[model samples]
Target: MRNVDIVQLSVFVLFLAAVTVVGFLAARWRRGQTLMHLDEWGLGGRGFGTFVTWFLLGGDLYTAYTFIAVPAAVFAGGAMGFWAVPYGAIAYPLVFLIGPRLWSVSHRHGYVTTADFVHGRFGSRALGLAVALTGILAMMPYIALQLVGVQAVLTVMGITGTGPAADLPLFLAFALLAAYTYTSGLRAPALISFVKDTLLYLVVIVAIVYIPARLGGWGNVFDSAEAALSKPDPATGRPSGSLVTNEMTHWAYGTLALGSSLALFIYPHTVTGALAAGRRDVVRRNAAMLPAYSVVLGLLALLGYMALADPGVVAAVREAGNPQLAVPFLFDAAFPAWFAGVAFAAIGVGALVPAAIMSIAASNLFTRNVYTAFLRPDATPEEETRVAQLVSLLVKAGALVFVFAFGRSLAINMQLLGGIWVVQTFPALALGVFTRWFHRWALLAGWAAGMVYGTWTAYLSSSPAQEHFASPLAEIPFLERNGYVALTAFVLNMLVVVALTVAFRAFGVPDGADETSPADYTADAADRLAAPEDPGRALTGEGPR
Candidate 1:
């Protein structure tokens, strides 16, 4: 492919600068006299209403990972990639049923992190700490996958498209993102998402409609793909892993979409996005509306299939020699160079929006759980904000290691593996939301069993083509009869919790104090303004806001 033009590069840079400005200005947009408080920093002053919550949750859930990886999967495989669309569509109803209650419980009890809620609900600090660590662990790699999304765009526009300085451009983007996020907290990402998602929708729509016409029609485009993929492997005289026959990868990707969507809200960042809403109704409305983004996701994933349909597009992307760059190359070859630049920028911005939010979410967990729990027991609101700011940078730095260490292909796989690891926390975070009677000790063992089982199952699987564990996205590890491991692990987690609860009752194992009641979980509208720490903490030595 030709080198990116100065005009195209300038357009990309211009949009990034616009986003940074938006992020910085958002500090004042949602004006709070004191940005010193954890409430203000971590949750965006908890004042975003229906309209902003639409953008905020839209930004948080449907990230660059959705834009880049989903397309790449569709491009690499086939219809299984479309699983993301249905998963997201179904997630809305799931959230609608559960989200309001989660918001109510979090608000009334002053829980900033899911760990805080678990600890309060079950009266088990060790269990809460485990949940918090799992959240941080799962989120960091997921964030790195977003950074890799930026790299995928850069590889097409710079490193592979141009030459050298490929690394520099992404570094520059991250430096600016980290600066703004550190300065503005969750507000930076929430504010920037409006621009990021708009550009993405526009670019995806144009690519889907325009590319079909340019190639053949939609029918011809798919027909060409079927022919291309059906061809002999040339050397091997066998098709290169037929989508229909590759049951392992297909089941894996499909199940991953289903399981990951379930795990999505369990992530602390997702909860942060939900709780940042000014009203519980805002969350309810967004849950119903957010699936609209899946239309764009389906189109983007189809871009991958479109790439496979046309060999000219494929050969051009091969110059860059990375699968994830397939989307940018397809756009560059099929569309005008200027639009390609805009699409690239859209993906780059898409990456930054979620990366910033994820870093904030993980850092918020660290500050609220670890620092406040064991370190500065008497830290003020201002000090808590400072701690979160520092931890946010460190979380990014940790994710940055994964981004460079594995680059795109492995980073994506790591994100899938990370999902399995993180999904292990779902039993504690999700089930505990509805009940406080699971017995804290049982929940702890369930979490431990899940973490062990999910990791071991993922580790045991490998692909001859990829020469690695192919991840949960590619290989759905099942039992003797076959079933999803993440889902399986979750059942085991629940079974352990239930069995232990029964046994503990027989033996009279003391269930810890239940801090949250049913009424507490179903908080009223007036409960939204409660502080992020429990007032009961003042009675204990847990300090005050």
Candidate 2:
């Protein structure tokens, strides 16, 4: 057993309790007629302005796993881990272009989930179901990684116990998360994000500035990290990593950044955040402004190097045999007890915000696409909202299961695996936003091929620590150079989609009816008055007017 820090635990608990109260109060913050509708519960009544949308999307995308895992990756792998910084930078431009279009269409048509948009656009429930299931599958590990973030902080605070009881603190924290998420729906996270983001920014800014000062400045920190990383690893008989990427590793680094950027906004949670905006301009403005978080991400990644500069932190991490502890341990050792407690609370609350949003997003997909479409086509809006609320709880429970089952391995890899599955939906959801020229059946077939190839390639990837799902990089077929497996699989997915589209057209196969029009993609909130409730009318050439 480890000695728990009483002052730190008390401060952490106080901040957590404060947020728990705020979360429950959010249900009445902006009251709708009732919380019995998906518009209010699943999408926060679709009325968030620029201020709220910025925080919500920032809190959602820059998650606790980001706080813990990115730094941990930097601590373990050196320069390659900085891929997260560039990928984050690249994602926002893509979001700026795609976000407004998706928000406009989703706003006009009352789409609560990406799957709903897919079903309407392609006029193929089968394709919609594929997207829905893939989203749910991808989210499991991602949500679990958030809990792993909390666990790492707890472990650093010496709150751990033996065996099954060790996880009690994690479950208890998530239980609080589930309660408010069920009660307030999207509003819980939207309101709580203010607190989460504020604390996170305060903690990160202080840590970056103060820690570097304490460690003899940034230059010394980098020199120490470089010396540490340049040492040969006994397991691989190679240098752990370097301060810069060389030719041999450049392709892997570039592809990882590019593939991650493509996958970022395609996540159901990000889509949920974008669609919740009050206007199309909210999405665009937030996308243009959200790069501010990327600066914080770069600062956070530098903490890994700072930790390497501190011999105490390095020794503690070596003893724990877990790199995820680097950031938490760094803060704990480098700061006073009260400030360290505040930092811990920041990470913990950071987990709650995104975990709540992700579960809500996943539940929205299930309730709209899976439950209503297949289980109860005639289900009322009230029934749909109720089902979504319950599934949100189940999604949290499933993530808990994932945490226990997977143990506390590398949290970043788990997120990358989720990204691999989520990116497959891009052709259908992201591409479909601008065009329906590709046959719906071909999109379905391509999704299947990408899923199979990505999963198999990830399975074959082995590292010194694990056998399967060991790394996100695999050798690109024919290229013989290692790169992100997701991108390779995505290329295969697109090729299949293109080839099948041509053949199906040549054979005169019937393309599914398109339910969306060009105007729909560009429509603003002002156009909502004329938007169609019945998308099927477009199938009969009676388009929404």
Q: Estimate each model's TM-score.
A: 0.92, 0.97
* Candidates in order: C-alpha RMSD to true structure: 2.9, 2.2
Q: What C-alpha root-mean-square deviation, in Å, does candidate 1 show against the real structure?
A: 2.9
Q: What CA RMSD would candidate 2 show?
A: 2.2
Model 1: clashing residue pairs?
A: 75-304
Which residue runs of candidate 1 sit more than 4 Å off their true CA positions?
160-166, 232-238, 241-254, 464-469, 473-484, 528-545
- Model 2, global lDDT: 0.88
Top candidate, metric lDDT: 2
lDDT score of residue 228 within candidate 2: 92
Cα lDDT, all candidates: 0.75, 0.88
lDDT of 1 by residue, 501-529 (tens): 88998899987776677876677557643
Q: How close is candidate 2 to the true structure, as a TM-score?
A: 0.97
Candidate 2 error regions (>4 Å): 529-545
